[model samples]
Target: MSEVWAERQRRTNQLVRGIARKVLEGPIDGNRLYGLCRLTWITEAYDAEHPAYIRSTKIPALGDALHQNFTGRTLDEVANEVATQLERPELETLVRSHTGFTNFYKAYRNSAREWMLMHEAEITAIFQRAYLLQSDADAQLLGADIAALPSIPKANHPHLLMRPEYLLTPACFALDPRLRFPILNGAERVQSVLRRIGAADRSVPAQIQLFVGLIGQNGVRDAADLDQLGLTALDGLGRADHEPMRQLLMHVPDEGDSLPLKDEEDVRRLQQALDVAQRRVHNSMTNKLRQLLANWTLLEGRAKDCRYDVLVKGYDGGDNDLLLEVKSSVDSAQIRMAIGQVYDYWHRLMGPSSDCHAAIVLPGRPDTATEELLQWLEVGLLWLEGGQLYTSTEWLEEFVAAVGPKK
Candidate 1:
């Protein structure tokens, strides 16, 4: 057999086995399966209901339009082809005319890259345990394993961990409606896809290794190294041993994807963290807003990750909605690095309908240094602690009352 045909057979075998294990694992939820599809195929095969639901849970307008005007077969039965898997019509409509897919792809891809780095829990251990056979692997093998894994490539620069440049092409996938699978408990199904693909379990292919090295090299422009990014070169790849391919394998959706909150306790914990952050910002900012009608809101990171110590609000909200972005750290090298995060939030906040303001909650007394940063914010500075946000005594009762128990 020719080299191309042989490679195709190998990939077909891997995909078949992968799909088999995924099926044995259980019938995946439509949404989770849609996420997996984003990696495996071109189109993300979500029906009106799923995307509508996702939009509601995340963005109401996105959900509403998703409720309308999206009906395609998603499959070409005769030829077995899938189309428009990564493209969301409603979402595309919202941003396409403005920034177009080029910008959207860049932003989404960047977001995914940052997210993978954030969930850097015992990815190695998870891979080793479930897949087995990782025992006593030497440095080269371990490096190969890291390089081989597609989702998170261990870059040539070990210190940088998984660099973003290694992300695979056709970087998104949708669902295949023709196949019947169980609806996941939301992102759980996506996570399962990561595990099954050996990305979660640390299995990877060769492309990811090169991709990692390439990304690690920053932006080297050597012709030979860059030649592998074309569509034809990607045709036979199924994430068997490619480094960039592993990223495609493991890049599942995480936002607002959680199993049902099992009990009141779970709800309360989520509420407490949310409430503490909310009230602290509110009380601290009310006075500042009084100075200027700084339109603002807040966005926090997943409470679990420790990359950033705190969340803060800055002025750049949409004309109406407050735009807040989280800063992972404040002590970076650049003078404006931390402040720029706070600054960007303010810029996004100043929408057609509102004015932008800003603030950063320092873990310590940012007194003199932070004061200098405040000149950049429309909303003046204030410290964050229990007493400042509200009466020291009223905090618990107020926080709980403001944040009631879940239904």
Candidate 2:
């Protein structure tokens, strides 16, 4: 099993590196561009309706494309291969018919050549510099060069060279045989990890350099190993050992601290503390909902990384559309935290188009100033008053009125 896995990894890396070299060489054509496009991971993968739904779903097709003799194929032929080869007819139809895909594919095949022809020299030079980035100064110059590249007209969907992660950084990784540059496509995960580990530098280029530095400081073999560790830590997969990987992830020493500590341990300690404190509040909220709003079922809602407390099921027992975050106090800090949590739970966790309701519950009523702030942000506020639940938002008031028994 281990041998097979290693061989698979080796082959994948070889393919990626080969494409990366081709990209750095000038006089790129449609076939080479198509290969790069297949290598590029777009942000639209997050959208289920899009052709590239989950990135992994296209892996087989991508592998076929990489290995096939597809030199003279047109854009339509490439799309057809991507669609029909995947064993999913629906995806084939989507690739062939979806307007977003059509727009992007047309733009890629028709316009990419002209654009690359115009900027190929500058692009190659920038990536060559990125290949040997040594210090912060080098990284900064590379970033500036990329930023200064003449802007192409924005497309309805992303293309091969659309974003830094889509092409440049990956190409840099491919060009460098040592795999120094870790892919920054998952920048949000990197940012979250930095915050969790207590790093102060949040800029993208700085973050990339810091990651490379961490790879060396922690004795990581290469960017490939670091990338595996990242997926293991963030996406919760890959075969990297958990305890040692946790140490790597948590290596940044806290301010005024002597040495690095396991960040997962720190997070566990903090989470345990929060859970202990929220136990009573959760129980009280549970009892109140059970007594006052019996019809609305109470459940827990989970996002990718964390779970939000108290999902109030819709009246018809349909979607859990009402998200309630319980905080221990009505203090300014707690209110601010609740606001961010509820908003993230509603907008990010539950899709922005979910038409969900979210609110913060506190032990006591907030001061007028705090109330005004909540109102200004259009966040609903609920509090405990005289052994009963009370709400400041009229929609909430109407909801309770319509559902719960009189008073």
TM per prediction: 0.21, 0.36
Count of backbone clashes, every candidate in sequence? 53, 0
lDDT accuracy of residue 163 in candidate 1: 33
Identify the leading candidate in terms of TM-score. Answer: 2
* Candidate 1: stretches off by over 4 Å: 1-19, 22-50, 53-207, 213-358, 362-407
Residue 230 deviation, candidate 2, in Å?
Answer: 4.4
**Cα-based RMSD of the predictions, in order?**
20.5, 15.6
Clashes of 1: 53
- Can you write out model 1's per-residue Cα lDDT over 1-407, one digit (the tens) per residue? 01222222223223322332332243323222223222322113222333332221212211121222223321122012111322323323322111101111222433443444454332223222222322222222433433434443333433433332233221110111111111111133223433443444443333333323332221212211122122222211334344221111111112242322112232243353234343344333333322222112212222121112122222222133222222212332222443554454344333333444434433233445555555544433333333232111221233323322324
lDDT (Cα, tens digit) per residue for candidate 2, span 1-407: 11122222334344444444534454544444434444433335423355452233234324433455544554467557755554444434433332211112334433544554567667657655664566555665565565566544334444334443333555455445555665554345444555644443454566565666656533345665454344323221222343221112111222332322112232343353244344445455545654454434344432233355565656434443577777656667667767877887677554675455788888788899988888787788888766677777776786655554444
Candidate 1 whole-model C-alpha lDDT, 0 to 1: 0.27
lDDT of candidate 2 at residue 29, scale 0 to 100: 41
Residue 255's C-alpha lDDT in candidate 1?
A: 29
Query: What is the lDDT, from 0 to 100, of the residue 212 in candidate 2?
Result: 68
Superposed by TM-score, candidate 2 places the C-alpha of residue 6 at a distance from the truth, in angstroms, of 10
